[model samples]
Target: MEQITFSQLKKNLKKDTTGFKEIKLAVLGNCATQLLSHALRGYAYELKIALNVFDADYDQLEPQTLDPNSELFTFEPNYILIQLCSEKFQLEFCDLSPEEQESFADRVMARIQEYWRRVEARTKAPILQFDFIEIDDGVFGNFGLKTQKSFLYQIRKLNMLFSEAASKDKQVFPIALNSLSAQVGRDTFFDPQLFYIAKMPIQVDFLPQIAKRVFDTVEALVGHFRKCAVLDLDNTLWGGVVGDDGMEGIRIGELKDGKIYSDLQRYFKALRNRGILLAVCSKNEYDAAIRPFREHPEMVLREDDFVMFVANWEDKASNIRRIRETLNIGMDSIVFIDDNPFERNAVRSQIADLTVPELPPEPEKYLDFLRKSNLFETVSVSGEDAKRTQQYREEAQRTESAATFASYDEYLQSLEMVAEAKPFDSFHFARIAQLTQRSNQFNLRTIRYTESDIKSISEDDHFITLYFTLKDKFGDHGLISVVVLEKRDNGTLFINEFLMSCRVLKRGMEEFIINKIVNTAKENGFTLVEGEYIKTQKNAMVANLYTQHGFTDRGNGIFHADPNTYIFTPNFIQEN
Candidate 1:
């Protein structure tokens, strides 16, 4: 997220956004929010998203939230943003008694959580709450942290309490303005003069980047985020090429400038630990590229660390395309990192959708530059994420094993794939919510659900929700699919949502799921099973999904089938 000048953002307000994806957002702030609202909408245009922010009237947060019939709810926003400035918070804290200040963090949290619950009670829109940035009045000086009644103590405690609250309630997302303030100097992050004059807390010069950060979180929540990082080996991963430098000559560890590369590896390792897949795309012989990972004692990344390793003389672009195809992810969901400008430009030019970061000339600066860029921000992480690399490695094995079989059906049958479908449970709510937000190409209406939404649907008698998982000889594809059916009064079951991980495509998982849907409808005494295919930019793969599952197209994007007469689709997958 590059910084945009005040004028640049104002000019962006006039750009065309006719076809961009529109997201309804409700903004409630304690200070003037008109500029922030405009900056967000305009910055979103750069990302090809039309952010429709509905800024509430000045200082009307409590009244608008307390009133159920207010315009806030009437707008029906998909997201709700509440920004309460530190400037306001400091003033409020100063007015408190010493006894009251002792519980300042708790008191503030209770109030903030009230807003969250009130918003959730009125609407299911995800709440984005801005946490207070750091502020010290030098009242207690260095001892403020030890003193519970100090502003420094309460402010830090409040941020932690806010994080814990957000963790317990998945509907709440805390935006870290404090972290941003720390990164850019506080002098740049806040404007005392602007606050006094126009009631705007943040500096105009920093609004563009701040707006971009907000949108980044929004993008991740809406199922648009990077999943993989493609790294170039030479100076990118180590100091020199393994082919030319040989095993003993390459610099990777703490002998000299090699510490830089090691630091970079550690950062990438942290990313991998949180569920991002790592892959190698180097221009060297497979043996030479594999040697360092296999034999180098100084190397932090082993051969097993990467899910996909493509080392050949082929053009980097072609290699990247092959990697994308194997992973079953869009090109946009990848970040290509290389120390060589030629390689970065070559790959970026060919793949317009891929993210390529510009590394500083100095190797030491690479990690900071990439970290500051925030290329891999995600809203949630599940246990399934940490095991992602292993799962993909298993997938590669499955693909290689398939080539040995004479027939595709025989290959699938040999794998002994078993699928388990169950009602939505709290244990899998995180993964289920993630699937709804992440799965795109296979999603049939493309409706995203938060964990709170999943919890509600699980208990709602009017809806039938099923979470599906597939396991085979290779490994378990954890929570691969989700199906939500809305029970209708007329003995018909409407398929409200049908989505699955694209990695499990062409494995008869679709057929297995459809058969179960039909059986479930019949068991529940639903005579008719109704569905629809809503076309999206990425979901054309499932445009004819209903028709393929023995559903008769009823025109206008609707389809129907008689559950009593529905024949199960043929597939080798067995129910567990």
Candidate 2:
């Protein structure tokens, strides 16, 4: 395989935003070998990953070069890539007698294995490590008639050893095989056994593609999150401004230019379906902008498709602020998309954290632009994504109703708030887990549990996993909040895990849940409701949730809410 230059590999690594933490490579050759060394250095610079290049060419070094008393082998790397070639293999038998060759090879293997064992023991600082085996013509030249069989046996043995080692060490040991010569073929000299031995192919021409696949695989194994794209209406949803062009005049249909806008809408809809929160921020009359969505025949997006809508002449920055505040998400989590460059630039300038993509002049390029921006690329989508828009819409309605109420209690009363808390089952486990993962603000413990972990909680009687669906006069906010409660033996209800969707924050959802907990505790004869405020980078909004709900601080990061002092409106349940 042709080798990649250090500069080229570095450039690609820098561009690789695939979110891999570390790159560990093992080179089994002269440490000074320019190509591999350069590639390793480049990767370190580009990916910002810790590079661990192992010098495997023991034969090339002077005898007893890495003495046990020396410091050559003391340094440890996050990843260890072993470049195993015939040249390095010769080092094992260089000073050995004919009868000692087998013993020497065994001893060498044992040492390498032991080193890996130590590396695996240090798992607190996990490292991505791999080995690269180079197939060169020297192996065939040295073994001559037995070259094929010997090479096959060695490869198989090495694979088995690595696989066993990986399982024992709990470290990923991927072996990348590179065939330098083109003379070998499957029918002529190639061995099917090699297929099982090699984990990744070393193709010269498709190195970039291969690297990208590896990066993607690693990211999928880990997980990644990016900003959500908040779309706009009028020229954004279709081709023309709905307020000026009227519903029928908006270019969105199956014909010519209209098809382009339709396609763009379809693209946006697909993105929405994949958990990207779709919100409309159009500078037009509410009814006028929403009319095309309701009455237009060619419209792909409906009124229910959006999470939030800001249809007014107010500054878009203000509307965006409202959306962010209501959602309880940071300004950085949003991406504003508008057809007008001025609007896009305005939001971009005002909200430095908000990501605003340049609007394409032609509708046909909308999808392409979105793809290139990579704003919504993620590892997985939880069920919470599907109902995100509905949740936001419900919050918007709650905000509107709050304006009409005289006092906070009156607003809470008017909400007709119903907090439908249910034990998490298979149907909602995924969403519950997702909320734990993505929800930042309003998260109590900020303990991110996976779906499987949540599912396993059912077996424990002391642990309670419950999710809440809030609905009022405006709409049903599907699965707005989740609370995983743990029962302690001291007659206390411990708030183990608590998270609320950004859409439902400040809508009396938390208050309603607290009231329910208090009532439940009172009925069940519990003394106090205890909670903890686990600090996180994003959940400062709810740092005082327990205190706000009348929880008294009990030092050492613990708070207690008195069940007796809690006041509840008798009609809270009847109204819902």
Candidate 3:
């Protein structure tokens, strides 16, 4: 089979990111061609994967280049690929007597095996092992039946070697073919279609395809993931500024100039559907900026579509900082998209790691640019993503209502919040773990666990994981909080983990959940509700939650909240 073409290689490499610490590659020379070498170099850029390519030649030649630190080893690669080419070559030959032929074969084969073992010992990085094309007489010329049989035998041996390597621990098989029908004479034996369909290994048919796959794989591996997409109001989501054009005069809807902005809004809607968190960071009067969202006829995105909105006349960077703080996500996880270049640059300068895309002046290219960037390609999404925007909108309304009350307790009472706590089952395990990993500000313990851990907890009756979905007059905050409690023998509810989405903070959600836990403990004949506060860089907001709930500081980052002393009353609505 021929090597993959350049275009196909590029396409495949763009599939993901490569941040792997160590990578091993085995190269077999079919001809005196450097095409594979050039391809490897190009792929390194696309995948961002650091690989040490070992080049081994089947035919002996004088050593031209050698570097102890270089990833490429020519002699060793040649021996390994040649030894695996035929069964006539014995593994014992690697330790045979020093006859001229035996010594040459033994030296090459032994060095390859030794180098591979040594490198494997040196690092824990994943290895991608490749087998060079094993060309025989039947592949090169119009050979008779015997020649074709021999050729098939060589190919079978190569396939076996690839299969064996793949079976080894942490070894990846990357099958690369130059073309679909490059060797037409040998088409009967080498079925390219079968290889592609069976997926025997991660195959790259052409150069462009290989490049693209490498890029994609490396991008995913890097894990430089971004979460929130912060948008600017006026000339961003819609065409014109609400302050200048008024609600009706804004360039939005099906009108001639409005279609572009309307389409842009639809694009954001699609992103939201895919679980990309949306927030607004604008320097406009809150009322004016929100007017179109509340009243515009053709607007697809409403106030409920944003997880957070900083619509005051604050500096753009400051507004972004506030959103980041409110959401409790890293600034690096945020992508600030604004129409104004100045605002974008300002955010880029102020927030060291924040991603600010250069906005195209023409409205038609905005969607295309974002699609090409692929900045929001996350690994997985949980139910929390879908409900996050609505939860934040509810939070904004709650904050506004809270201002009218004189005290925090009075405001919480006016809302009449009820937190329905149910034990986590299979349906909520993934979401629970996701909340634990993502929630920051109100996460008391901030101990992130995987889905498997959550599943294990569900299996054990001692562990009670409950998620709280809060709803009141404002709106429904779907699955806003989760608390994991472990029941001890002494009838005390030990809060193993507690996390509330930043969107639901300051809304009595935490207090309400704590009250529910206490009530559950009292009903179960438990004596006390205990919890711990683990110090983290991000969870300072929740460090004092135990104290607020009448939990006495018990030293060593532990607290004991007295159930009898806890007094929680809903002001706006009654418990269900």
Candidate 4:
């Protein structure tokens, strides 16, 4: 792949971004960031985001944040990106006394946090804090890492403190420039000549990578990210074809160069543990495809690890479509990995918007390539994420069991589905916020919220929030739905936000939720319940959702229901 030069990205500044989503970003830093400002915008243009940047003047990181009426506040950024270079910071560290130096990390964090507090107090935008890159001054050489006062130790310590601060405050998301510098050798990442000539810490050659990392987080925050990894079984997961290479013949554990596959498997398992779904797609016989996962001692990913497994002789593209449909996720939100160039291209040609990386022929580079691609970047993970595979497995079982019953309603009743719908609490704030961001297809109004927003909504008297959790004879669907009802001055209870996870769709959850909403409106003495369906490329599934729930479409996406006349929709779900 050809490198996207900073100059190349600069050319995109003039490109018309008419239809792109407008995402305001305020970039503030201590160093000269004029070039970086354009580079970020350019990269955003490439990603179909109209990134309106409020690039602050050089070294104005704090004053702009501290002032309540500053242009930074006026910009009203969706994200605030700060890049404080080590060149300026390390000089400040050198001026401090030995005692101050030892505690320099803590002192710096105190000031950094003050900036965060000032910005957050002014606006609800999430701050994207770019961490310090390495400064290999080589005074103490390798010993500097162990010395607390050393610039090497202090900078790394400062980065750790940034992470610690971000963990405590959900609004602060630290971008790992330190890791990026380390990945592409520090010398290649930073140019001493460039820093001395201009206050640029990062080389122009590396600015695109920095911009990409920032936008990766931005994309994820805006509810656009890959959620699943659809992998080929032969050679991609294992080393060779499991159909031809028998169970013992496959190169997985003890075979020559099998450690490569083993290491990659460990990484995939870690990904699954973190909430990303895994699906298997192979053009082999069903028995041959699944035998390794079930019987092979060397296999790290078991049959249960996959949410869906398609092992048919169909074209890989058709199989991937089935997997995407079964999962009910956008085709773009999946990453397909195959060792064969033909298979990868075949899928790429057939499936628009799908991500299919041309894997290296060399087996050893496969894991590193995918890691560097950063294919599955996501914003938040809840306890529900870790159990996603199991939940999907249960859904498959329910599907199978439904086939035995005569009617769908009878099947739903047989499961004895129970749901808990109640006001939002502090305990589920993270999950509630996550659903607002990730639940795309069923979302009405498509409004996104952060954890801080969720907390604020829960405490606001003008808003009524409800989060739903479903459990049945099969398994629990943890916190699948969120409704934010805003009390309006027009004698109506407005459905400000309505979204549910697609996994729980068509299971009477919508009926159950609508019933709850109408009842709440009646109890609150609001006769009119207003709703809307703002259409999107992916949310067509909910275009007529209001009409289906007995709400009259008043045209132009506006919907309304009279609570006094609202008939309770029949549902199999029992409110527990």
TM-score winner: 4
TM-score of each: 0.97, 0.59, 0.56, 0.98
Model 4 weakest lDDT span, ten residues long: 1-10
Give the root-mean-square deviation of each candidate in angstroms: 1.4, 11.4, 13.8, 1.2
Q: CA lDDT of 118 in candidate 2?
A: 50
Angstrom error of the Cα, residue 35, model 4: value is 1.4
TM-score of 3: 0.56
Task: Flag the better candidate by lDDT, 3 or 4.
Answer: 4
Model 1, span 1-576: residue lDDT tens: 235676787888898889888889999999999998988888878888877878998888888889999999999998898888877888999999999999999999999889888888999888888878878867999999899989999988988998898999988887767888888888877888998999998888878777777877898899999999999999889998789989778889965689988989989898998999999999999998899899989999888889999999999999999999999999989999999988888887888999988888888889988987889988888889998998999999999999999999999999999999999999989998888888889999999888888898999999998988999998998889999999998999999989999889999999988888889999999999999888888999999988988899999899999989998889989899
lDDT of 2 by residue, 149-257 (tens): 3433354355456556655443443433322123233232233343234321232233333343234333322333444567777666777777777777778896447
Candidate 4 residue spans exceeding 4 A from truth: none
lDDT of 2: 0.61
Query: What is the overall TM-score of model 1 with all chains considered together?
Result: 0.97
Tell me the tens digit of each residue's lDDT in model 4 across 148-215.
86988988888888888888898988787888888888778888899899989888988898888888
What's the residue-level lDDT of 161 in candidate 3? 51
lDDT of each: 0.89, 0.61, 0.62, 0.89
